[model samples]
Target: MTAFGISAFGAYVPRLRLDRAIIADAHRWAMPGLRSAAKGSRAFANWDEDAITMAVEAARDALADRDLSKVAALRLASTSLPFADLQNAAIVARAIDAPHQIASSDVAGSQRAGTSALLQALKGTQAELVIGSDHPSAKPASVQELTF
Candidate 1:
């Protein structure tokens, strides 16, 4: 049996961190409990950020000191994918200038997507790159907005 493992890894967080207090103040009347989470900040994706873009950024980070040619596959995991019918992993692979022969796939639909993709990648025959990102949009003054 062959052992599959991560040879290199990297991560990227959005520069913008929205203070939870802002959300609590904005909807304190509707959802008073939001104040409880006002101690920390949440990553805020830019207007142009989608799962593909963020995944590309993260992949670039991971590949910065490594050879892109060694990557055999690219897997993207996200719940807030921009396109419902498009190939997200392919886009990310292209944006990062990955080799044309590299296999690409997307894992989505739930929070488990990230972990599931990682597990799948670890079982693959070659070096696999798995990326996860989310850009959730929610209604104003709703608890969903505060949480997501």
Candidate 2:
């Protein structure tokens, strides 16, 4: 059997970071438990950045000094996609200037989206670009907001 493995890998982190302590302090009155978990900070995407943009960045990084024509497929995993009606992966593909015929898909809905896409990519025969990017937006004072 032919071997299929990752040849290159890359990641992108938003330049802006919001300290957890600030988040905790903002909602300390409602959730006192947040104070203890406020040691580090979390990456904050800029107003112009979204899951698609971040994925494109990471994909470009991974493709650096590499041939984009080799990519046969693209799988973007995210719980917070920008569009519901449009194909989000296609946007990433376009941003990265991938081949027009490349297969593109968006994996979402649950937390397992990223892992599932990775597994699929590993099992596929073609050269696949699997990207996991999420811009989590949660309600104020919620655990998700505090953690994400």
lDDT of each: 0.85, 0.91
**lDDT of model 2 at residue 113?**
100
Could you give me the TM-score of model 1 versus the true structure? 0.88
Model 1, residue 126: C-alpha shift (Å):
0.8
Model 2 misplaced stretches (Cα beyond 4 Å): 1-3
lDDT string for model 1 (74-131, tens) is 8899998998888889988888889999999889988999999999998778888999
For 1-148, candidate 2 gives per-residue lDDT tens digits of 7657888999999999888899889998889898888888888889999999999899989999888897899999999999999999999999999999999999999999999999999988889999999998988877676577
RMSD of 2: 1.6
Tally clashes: model 1: 0
Model 1 per-residue lDDT at 31: 82
Q: How many backbone clashes does candidate 2 have?
A: 0
